[model samples]
Target: MSRATATATGFIAVLLWALLALFTVGSSPTPPLLLNTLCFGIGGIVGLIWAWATGSVPQMRTVPLRVYAFGALGLFAYHLLYFSALRLAPAAEAGLIAYLWPLLIVVFSGLLPSETLKAGHVIGAILGFSGAALIISGGGAGLSTEYLPGYLLALLAAFTWAGYSVLSRLVGSAPTASVAVFCIATSLLSFPLHLMFEETVFPTTALGWASIAGLGLGPVGFAFYVWDIGCKHGDIQLLGTSSYAAPLLSTLVLILAGIAAPSMTLLWATLLITGGAGVAARASFSSN
Candidate 1:
């Protein structure tokens, strides 16, 4: 694909991810563990089928075991923490906090060989963290002691995803195959946890089923493959900077879904986060 097409694809993937909070809203009849199990299980099956159709199945075995191990653990941890946090705190707050992965990516990317940390990146990181702080202080139903654990989980989700993204760049496997492996591994790991700690509760309504399907097909599934392509072939700086839009879009989605409402704090947080991303993007391009 052309750079423009690849970049657009990347943005579309992120936008689809924004809908995750919307789909998962309200008290789930399904436990988080089982929800993840079903979602990733379905997604993994789809991914495997896709990989087979695209003749990427053979490539799966060619990948290093270390890559598979990291991908599985990272993906598993990210979703586990993210879904758990959503149950504990308001989705908007948890999402914004979890969205810190982009900023973390910017920082961690600097650690790669031949990459340099620039002043704009530093400034952008500061601004981004400031926005995150603002959100934590005022974003959701208000930060309280009750939500502390959720907040920490969201932060850990961010960290896990950042590390995953960075490590993905080092892996030489076909992205689709790798993602399929990750999904299957996560599902397998979730099985024991689900059996041990949570009862299976299937979706009771059509809307709930639809939400599960959407999560499996889009955000947790095909989007990962598209993102891998984007990162490999798209305008890296643009993708990096525009990633901040994911949280903003996700917040808007929640508002429209009646899961959240617009507020001054969210507006201010948007400005800070978007501005920070822009600064970092500019610096990244200039450095290149």
Candidate 2:
């Protein structure tokens, strides 16, 4: 896909994730655990199909199973923390705070052999982190107590994502299958956890299925794979930086769906974030 198209796809994936989170709010019959598990289970299947569709899975022959094994481990650990964070935090808060991973990627990427920190990178990181902080803490102004736990969870999610973002780069050229295989494996890991904590499986509901499909196909299955591919060929900071756009699109979807309302403060905060993301994307890709 072209850069614009891929970016749009990524943004849409994040928006879908946000929507899934919103749908979970007033669910009647399904518990969050089973619903989440079903979503991931379905996502694993979708990722497999998507990798096949894009010819990413077949590329595995060129990459060693050992490296792919590492990729799988990274993917599993990342999802474990991501899901746990969601259970602990609010969607908007977790989503916004977790947006920091791109900046984290830059910081970590600097330690890599060829990566360099440009002035744009530093400036962009500040703007991005500040904007994300504002959104999570409350309207880009100050922090609030009620949302504290959510902010922490989101931060942890960012850490998990950043770690994977960095480590995936080390795997170098591993086909998309590595991530897909790991996603499927990690998804299975969570199912047992779900069963252990929950009483019963979720009944089949259209809304329930819809949320599962969205989470799996859009975010977990597709986006994660796309991200891994980018990590394979592109600068992690660039791909991660462009991710700031996801929350902007996601928050807009939330507003349009009446799941959440927008405010002047949030608008400004988004400006900072999206602005930083643009700068960072441009800088990271310049070397390409």
Question: Candidate 2 lDDT, tens digit per residue, 37-131?
Answer: 66556667877777788777667567777676676566566555555455555555555566666667766666688888777777877887787
Compared with the true structure, model 2 gives a TM-score of 0.75
TM-score of each: 0.91, 0.75
lDDT of 2 at 70: 72
lDDT of 1 by residue, 99-171 (tens): 8788778778888999999999899888877877877775555656677788778888988998888877787
Best-matching candidate per TM-score: 1
Summed backbone clashes in each candidate are: 0, 1
lDDT against the true structure, each candidate: 0.80, 0.63
What is the lDDT, from 0 to 100, of the residue 210 in candidate 2?
66
lDDT of 1: 0.80
Candidate 1 segments exceeding 4 Å error:
1-3, 139-143, 171-173
Best by lDDT: 1
